[model samples]
Target: MTSAAPTPHTLLTPGPTPIHPRAVQALTRDMLGHMDPVVFALNRDIQQGLRDMYGAAPDTFTALLAGTGSLGMEAGFANLVESGDEVIVCANGSFGHRMAEMAARYGARVRLVTAPLGEAIRPEDVAAQLDDHVRMVAVVHGETSTGVLNPVPEIAELLRGRDTLLTVDAVTTAGMEPFHMQAWGVDYAYTGAQKCLSAPPGLAPIAVSDRAFARFHARRSPTPLWYADLDGLRDYWVHQSYHHTVPVNLHYALHAALSAALEEGLEVRQARAAHIGQAVYHTLEPLGFRHYVQDPAQRLPTVLALRLPDGLNDAAVRAELRQREISVTGGLGATAGLIWRLGLMGESARPAPYRTLMLALEDILGVPGLAGRFTETLTEIEDAVPA
Candidate 1:
């Protein structure tokens, strides 16, 4: 009998990035009852770790839901946005558009402020969209589509002193960048375990400020989604009230992932991400390439959006890279076919793989002089990777 071919797995995508071996082992740990004291202790530790990761206060209503980043987004909208309530959504990429869609599903009157793909939304533009009727202002901290980092701090400053709640999607920015929930005045924020956290996808790490919790308390109508209801989920996660079955092993993995982040230190992790991102840009820039987002300061460190070479097939190049055991991603939504989304996130966000990708691309594209430059870039990057 012929043996089945070995399965291959290479995740260089923006999300669901490569998981650490230790975290994967944590997932195989023995399971416990969700309400067990041991489980509760694990839960508490994870919540505190999340707060530390986000630079949030201890009293913040932070919880982990058993789902991807989208589940957290739904939870935020379902709990905070009531039917017919007006919300201002800033859309520059696919995830921003997704936030608006989720709000609209919750019966929110979504007033969208859009910027072109690969562009950042100016705070002035957001202020122009604000009205007395708007209850919440939603924005994506790091748009994975075009690798543009929106000006959350500026937008938050603009919304200060106003009754409007500020919600942010930090899915790609959470562990990879510097995000301070309390300092930034973000009322609610959500991220996934897969991206910068370097864990398997499933658990959504969510944080809500005291003011956002008060809004939840004052809600007159029921949340549209049952599983994503913050009130109910909070009861189970924080208050220890049984609502549904919690994934015990997944929680183990989450706790381990957070522990890894704490060990690495948030500042160090952020710097590492930034360093790798800059290395990638510097390596590509001299090869007649341009970034999708012009401003380097406003780009996401975890995801890089590069313009495809003239006359080169973007999809074909991605496929070629895959054959070499690398898996970069394509653009999302409106950016499809226009850019390549290279993720330098988590475990895979290192020099070796990135250098390998560059060399492989050079070999395939027959780009003269790339090999030598790639070698020099690799040496520089290797020296820069954290000890």
Candidate 2:
């Protein structure tokens, strides 16, 4: 007997989040010439929206690339760090390690300040790594691998009054978390449209401070990567200089997504994320599960990392959940078999899906006491739901 394919459902992963209906419509709208006035207007609106979302200074230059979050990571490093420069890369998770790799690819001498997965980097440790030769200090604002939220504000304060420029990977925290680029003293920052922005995967929204741009201008050798070179891409995005053909439909979708974010208000969006995260913590703690990150303050509201039960097969548990038409991710890199990372991001960062997930998981794990607790929790959740 043939079983039908699992029913399609919403994305509960950290990135490529659930898209708004309006944004989906924008993607289906008639495509226009890349150089058309209408397309250019859409690009302008996206840039402005990005600037507002980042809380960038008025003079900061913002651009969008036809790539994912990794492209933005490469762009920021390729444009800023030249050969023989020293850079400090914070490595608390997979994404932070990627930054170090990109810097090394560009010929920079990369020094790593690493912590165990699920642990935040101490600002003093970052400061200790800084030296006269260090040109940049790069950190990830939200490490999706372990659900650890790095203290970017504290790290920024440590770099204050220093010659080293600060760069942040806010791919998972951009719209959902509080990221004030100018106020946080981040000279360069990059994020993906798919994550907190709740847009489809494609465009990377990036912002650069005046100081970071000056460094780019001062590079003795041209940045090697053409597709990501800020000096050239900035002209195309801001001046309409036409470096390459733009993605018209994606830009329209991004514009609509940004508009929705603004209408929801950043504060409200952040509060929603926090509320869902708290509920998840409360719901999961009594199920014989424990968080990977011991400190609540270091955990991100969008992603939660749980240590699997002793003797339980992580992959099999994930497969069982998949059978029930629910999906959650495992940890990355060294923590893969040891942890399960559940993302409560954007539209999926709500109570209903989480409650459903808890019920499904309780049935799968089938621990002695978890089923009863899960039943009680589901009843409480149902009672809380509006009529």
Candidate 3:
């Protein structure tokens, strides 16, 4: 007798949301050698896709690093920072603090410009801390931990005409929202494939502006990390010389994912994310849930974090959802046990998955009409959104 069919799972966590079907198909295809001419063509296509996603200049350098988003973050600091160089890190959520920690490890004089947890960093606050000595300013476009969408464009504007370069962590916002690196003057930016791109994890796509590349070349000391060295990476990505074995299958998945994203249009995805955010907020508000981030403008539509009601058991609820094959994450670090992060990204940022979530929550919470309310809210949001 055949065993029972495997249970299907719905993923709503901030990272590694449901992989797009095209990417899944791509993953199952036959592999290619790292240095195959076909693989090189695929890589170029992926680079062009990334350039479009970030609105980068034609000459901006892009590469798919074989690691998670954190590697991209580290690479940004590893190449541009040196001992005794002052670097300003804008910190609000867990990821921002992680950036500060990474910068400190690189021997830079790390200056942290902070906001309260669950709040976005203020550009003016960052501006106030800037000085000629500050070599670079690092900021997060979407803080996954707290769902705060920091104003990178405004912060980039603040650094204009300064000697300082601006680096952005766009891990959660890249394909789901507007991110024009060239227009905003972002010197460097990076994102993971698992987030808005709806590809499998283990790939970090990065873009380096010409200015940032010049700074990379002008470093006072040799880059300490060989793996993350931008110059070495450029040799592999642009010059077609092997620095390491490229993850050909992962690139295949990313290529398909990018093709799907460009076909659907990024602005349409952004609107869908906004609709999801509104549906979640309105549907859960009646059940006594409130947003973790108070300011709507500062909240990320891609990741809506909600403060759990008093006396609610976070772990128990999440576990129940998990049992039903739905995955949602709880708070991290300082906000532990207080918030639930519901990711509406890429393939998961649609009505079907959200309806599944609402039904499960209704069953767990004993709210008789929660699912119906969610459907109504979703309808209202869709009607309001212009075609």
Candidate 4:
């Protein structure tokens, strides 16, 4: 017998998070020309929304680059790193290594301060590696691969009074976590529209401090190429001059997503995510599952990395969940075969996905009655929040 086309899965992976109906609706609006005044205004609104969310300084430049988060990562490096200059890459997981790789491609001397897969990078390790030649310091705010939130504020403080630029990869945590760009001293911060932003994948939103722009302005040579050049992007996004044609519809969608987040209030939204993440921990802990990141403070609210017990078939469990149109993921790199990654992001961070996913996990893992137990616990947690 043939089953119907698979139902829309509750997207529980980190990237390309579940988009809100409002954002999807925005995508269906009439397409505008890139040079249209309407699109220019929408693009400007998106950039302004980003700056407001980050609590950035007045001069901090915010814009949406065409590609996804990785493109922003490259742009961050391409604009700043020159040949033979030094950069400190903080590698506690996959994204950090990617930053280092981008720096290398731009001919910067790379120094890595990495922790184990499930641990956060130490601020002192970053401090110990600093020197006069270090032109930039790159760190991932949320290391999704390990479910660890790096100590970006502490790391930023370490770079205080130094001439080095501070760049953060906030792809997974932008809207879900508390963002304090001005107070945090982050020189250049970037996030993808896919994850916490809850928009369709494509746009890379970035915030750059004045100091970082000066470094780019004073570069010894022109930045690598036309597409991802920060200077050109700034001219178009900031000055409203025609640099390249943008994805007009996606900008509207991105604007919708950002506006929805801001309307909910960033602090309120972040607190809700925190509550939901705590609820997940409470629900899963009783079923003999242990989190990969031991320190609670180091964990990311968006992604849950769980360590299953012996004899459990990780693939089979994921397959069972997939059968029900649930889309939790597994680990990568050093964590392969050892963990399951359940993403609690944007729309998915609410109770519905958590309820469905926990029940499915109970059925797969043979945890009798634990799903019922989880429902009760999560209900109490949610009830505490004032609607």
Candidate 5:
């Protein structure tokens, strides 16, 4: 007996987003030794690409950590928070809460400034939690769990001119949204290769402002994690010194992905993301799915969390979609079993794949004309927006 052939999945999840064609092609290229001169050159290129995408200051230190986005989160806290350091974490969703937990684990005196799930964290609330003892303020630019985009700029303004450093988790917003680290007074920011970057997992791109670097340099205690030490990473990435074996193929893929993103221009890519997000929202609303994030301004265009219609079993629906070769994630933490987390990120943020997804959903939900309505609506949006 012959087994069934495997199917390709259209990934529409919060992370490990669809990889770009250029990145996929790069992954197939011959590998280079970790210490090869060409590898260092690729590191420089990746760092520069990150700086450009983040609008980082000229003196910023940028590098890629050989881990997932969670590692980036740990690096931010480990490098900056010393024992007894007062840190304010803005917890509006699951990612924000993770930062709070991580900060505490890193020996910080963690103070949580929280907002309800699906709502943007108020900058004033963060400001209220601030004190002279506060050493840093951590916020997630895009909360993947709830589809809420927090006001990082406003929160940065609260830390401006103060000794406090502002670190942002841009895991979902890195390539999808406009992020001006310098202008926004962000001291540190990090993202995953698997998100809007359109590269595969196993790399985390991080940016460190001079202010943040200085704080790390002044830490009385040594950083806890040897591998995550920014100084060691800097020596490896910036000074071409060996620290560990860098994943050469992932680097190649990331370099190609960044090159493609830059070639397309961030403004154009952002416009496309916005267009796709709106298209998804409009197409799904009439099908009984409701946006979990009530405020449109606070919603993430990359990852959308939608509350399922009454009587629909979340796991069963997701399982059905997966069987159809369409993969979207379910809600996380408190949102589990109540919502669906859909992503239209990077290479997946296009009309055709979403059309396929809609058609599949139509079939599953027994809605006869859903796909036609989606196509007509998308055409109207494309004509209006030119994405």
Candidate 6:
């Protein structure tokens, strides 16, 4: 007899996470005028929620761009870096390299401080690249490619009292973890709604400190890009001066997502992510799976990468999971086929998806006895999950 098929696929992939019900309902709302009072209220709440989630100071200028996470990266680089400016990019994974590329696009002289995959870049290594000429220091808070969570707080600390501005791609970390950008003195940080906020892709929420705004306004070059220009975005988001037609409908979904997150509270959301992460590590370690990331503490709770077990086919195992109606992804760049990335993000971080994943892994890894063990291991995780 065939095993029971796990129908109605559960999404367990990082980014573009399973959309929350509130977000889905949010999309069904009638569209409003961009300058409408209701929209302005939504814009205020979204911007405020972004500030609170990011740990931004009250004076920090925050806005949402109608694009994916990559566009936020471009806006951050373009607004700050100009011709002949020097920027330091901490490269530990694919996103870090993307930051360097973005800086180069703006004609900044980019210096890269890189580390091995699965290893977080050292603060000292980042400090080594610092000089008076370096105008900005960019790092990925959660390097999803390898599931390595960089030391953003320490890196932010290193830039303290220095002239170099700090920018972070918190695409995979922001709503799921404590970003601490204001406390860390980060000048600029950006996150997408898709990853941790449980929203569909499109809106990128960003926070920029007063100092960063000062630098942006002081730029020698006139803002070259119209759509993504921070100055125009600020005018629209802050003063309600029309920039372009603001995304009215996407705002509905994104606002509901952020509202759900705020309702859940950051501390609780973080704990939920941690609860799921512990269960994953607990199941994998005994099954003899090796972590791609060296330090467990440096691992991202939202995104986890593990080496594929010996004798297991990459496509076959993934296909098996797919047949079970579970959606997980593989590695990218140099780590492809060597590791698989499982996302425990937002609504996907809940126990049900993970229970299926664990069972699937047990079957795929040929551990028949793990069925009993999995049940025992998840009791603690189950207790913490909200009804």
Best by lDDT: 3
lDDT of 3 by residue, 123-225 (tens): 8899889988899999999999999999888898988898889999999999887789999999999999999999999999999999998998898899988
Candidate 1 regions with alpha-carbon error over 4 angstroms: 1-9, 367-372, 378-387
After TM-score superposition, what is the CA distance of residue 47 in candidate 3 from its true location, in Å?
0.8
Top TM-score prediction, candidate number: 3
lDDT by residue (tens digit), candidate 6, 73-119? 99988888898998999999899999998899889999999999899
lDDT (10s digit) by residue, model 4, range 1-387:
998985777888877789988999999999878888888788778878998877798767899888899999998888888999889999998899999998999998999999999999999899999988888899999998989999999998987888989999998888766799999899989898888879999999999999988898898999986797887887788777889988988898889999999888877778777777777778777666788999988988788888976777878888888889988778898788798877777887787777778777767777776556666777787788788
Worst 10 residues of 4 by lDDT: 366-375
lDDT of each: 0.85, 0.83, 0.91, 0.85, 0.88, 0.86
- What TM-score number comes out for model 1? 0.93
| Candidate 2 lDDT for residue 92 | 92
Ranking by lDDT: 3, 5, 6, 4, 1, 2
Inter-residue clash pairs, candidate 2: none
Q: What is the Cα-based TM-score of model 3?
A: 0.98
Indicate whether candidate 1 or candidate 6 has the larger lDDT.
6
* Candidate 5 error regions (>4 Å): 1-5
TM-score, per-candidate, Cα-based: 0.93, 0.92, 0.98, 0.95, 0.97, 0.94
Q: After aligning candidate 5 to the native by TM-score, how far in Å is the CA of 281 from where it should be?
A: 2.0
Model 6 error, position 213 (Å): 0.8
Cα lDDT tens digits for candidate 5, 330-354? 8888899988888867887887778
> Alpha carbon lDDT of residue 357, candidate 4?
80
